[model samples]
Target: MRAMARALPSLLLRLLLTSTPGALGTNPGLVARITDKGLEYVAREGSVVLQRELLRITLPDFTGDFKIKPFGRGHFEFHSLSIHSCELRGSALTPLPGQGLSLTISDSFIRVQGEWKVRKAFVLLSPAADSKTRIQARLHGSFDVQVKGITISVNLVLGREPSGRPTVTAPGCSSHIRDVEVDISGDLGWLLNLFHNKIESRFRRVLESKICEMLQNSVTSDLQPYLQTLPVKTKIDSFAGIDYSLMEAPRATAQMLDVMFKGEIFNRDHYSPVSFLAPVMSLPEQYNRMVYFAISDYVFNTASMVYHEAGFLNFSITDDMVPPGSNIRLTTKSFRPFVPRLARLYPNMNLELQGAMASAPFLNFSPGNLSLTPLMEIEAFVLLPSSAKEPVFQLVVATNISAMLTFNTSKITGFLKPGKIQVELKESKVGVFNVELLEALLNYYILNTLYPKVNGKLAEGFPLPLLKDIRLYDPVLEIHKDFLFLGTNLQYVRA
Candidate 1:
């Protein structure tokens, strides 16, 4: 169209001259231009509005095409036309702006914004038909479009914006269901042998299951607010992110026979929330584990959970696995009785209930039960500074533990055991934990048995047969503590 209108100020001046930040945080200025209202995009079988008949392809030959109509005024006309762009040079493309990509366009639709590394720069439409030989690969991105807001950076590595949350096991799970269904058995070769074979060969090599479920429902709507900060009672009904980005369709034999993945993990406030919320459980492999697109090896994770419990429930694949590649193991099944009339009808006076019961197996990489939410004011002190003569006894305590960053922080540091005072926690600038090792963790937690508990009145360390009573095993009665922790949500919080 007049060469896309004189290449719209040379692609918004190459997105204002490649935007910047390029050290690693990689922003590269993502530039744009060619507005007048155009480019509305969408994938997975719907939405399209292009221009200049171009959405083409590149490399050994994957073939391509995308052209739209309606232009001038309200505006329209989009294209990506690629017959072959010299094998996508650097790889990954998107609505990268400041350097080039803001895309808003409307008629049909177009939104896909930026940042978080433009997530493989959107545009992953693969039906598969070009491979005379050309896989050296290198695409890089910035094929953006935005109308009202004015951004049109489109050179066409061809795109950006695209992007798994799977783990649902509720003892009985009751409320919260808007409509979700996924039931499958063995297809993508049994999910390429159950999430193996390098994550089902990188989810069919990214491209087309409606453009990887529209980038796994846009990374399951951006990780449902960090899975709503976990811990309520574990019933998270749904949460998605599965953009199998085309899934390398060389031939395509079978994939959706009800292979699960319907989608609905709503906005729960909680009643018993133990949500590993399953929707197709692939949340972009927790951020690009090659966008994990394992199409079908095993998809049947039925969950309804809500107390009335059991135990030994662990699925598989989160890493740490070694030998020949662990294809899902440890299957036990639990949670069946815990409706104490819904825990006495919602008894959450700032909740704590997890003191003791008998249910403790959970170990696959531990880190649970722990809790804390101190992004900035965490001071765990116990100073004894005054050492000149004696009476120096001080202790400082704090707790706001917003509940160990969403379920299982190494078993919540194993129930926060780091307190025991008598003296020398390394000479006390702030007695640094391990003073009598909190008396051997208070004899295995209030006397369950790590031994020890004598003459301080059935309590306080040193009992287990009085270690030959060498004057109560002297060495200057040592003890101390210093754990100034103010940690919260283990990383990332710009807002």
Candidate 2:
């Protein structure tokens, strides 16, 4: 089973990067849509990143000396200045249609704390005494700085890297600081307050300058690098891996954003192309859900082809595999009534059936249902007392299997229901017998034995092709004319 978890940050980065001008505008096998409602969710998540990066901003230390001719001379230094906490009041992420995305953060607050030390010398020259008197004072204390009404705006431009990977660059970023307050707490703290105007002005200038720098670094250094590190191909299991390469650049509208993926499955060891091509898939214009994914029949067909080529669609059945207390048995006695030659030729001998799929199964999607058709060849042999076996007959079976698709938070599962079964005689060792009679026996075997085993495996559904750390919520799966539409909101959890 595969696990379906997508990192929200990766999705946003892809969308932002691919939404550049001059998109390919080709139809995709898989289409992922982010609606306006989803933008709100993204903004909330983005604010968390902004706050964390803002706390990492490094401000230069303040060191200088000042002279007051009549009063005295003073030297002060503020060191170890750092942001201790941050609070984001509001944030918005807006789509720019043909351009890229705009991120705005307003009215945020940051608290900074550091140590300040000052030394002052007061001198007086008396004319009568003709001697100079000097008084020196030194003060060291901790200062708290609060910056409020901090606004940051970033314009993300979309472009492609030399390697054809999507890239996001911040061409414009600006910041403003509305207020800065400083408080000194220590011995002679009141005297330090005398220079509060200068201290506040210096704090405001440093913060305003570094805010935009931090925002740009968050995109180019942090987000873009993470995006580049995401794998274009992900392994589903040992047998196969899924290709999530983009079919074309993404398209953005006033209401939503769309990203197209190749959505093909390939063999792990030997890659082979499927006979059929991917049909065009289109998502419905529904904005109620935060995200929507449209998966074409090509995805399932390619998987079927891969598994079939790997010899996974073969099985062997013997008498031991039959259910207990059943009238049916894989011995000559079971078929003696229909073919007397079986009993006369191999009396009381056991029987074994080996089945292999004739070709890769094909899946079809209709208005409300999904069905699979598989053709198989089964050979039956009679076991000899000397540990030898004699071929009794070979039969070809064709079946139509329908399933009701359902999904939980992580995976999509199905409950298969048998539809129609057809059987024909290919070869026979025993005297000619009615093929209809054999079909009846085989039908009973399938309904009573084979389906139970097959459905048991089907219940353990494969994981969806979502990235890590994301889970679907309130997922609704709908079958369309050649594809499946999954609409759901997503929850991102940090690992």
Query: What are the per-residue Cα lDDT tens digits for candidate 1 across 85-133?
Result: 1111111123333222222222222122111111111233345853243
Q: For residue 102, give model 2's deviation from the true position in Å.
A: 2.7
Give the Cα lDDT of each candidate: 0.21, 0.78
Q: Can you give the lDDT of residue 80 in candidate 1?
A: 37
Q: Over 4 Å off in model 1, which ranges?
A: 1-86, 92-417, 421-442, 446-495
lDDT of 2: 0.78
Could you give candidate 2's per-residue lDDT for residues 8-107 as a string of tens digits? 6676777876886333334455777878777778788879988988888888998777665554678888889999999987898777787767888899
Error of 2 at 117 (Å): 3.2
For each candidate, give its TM-score against the true structure: 0.17, 0.80
Clashing pairs in 2: 2-463, 5-467, 6-467
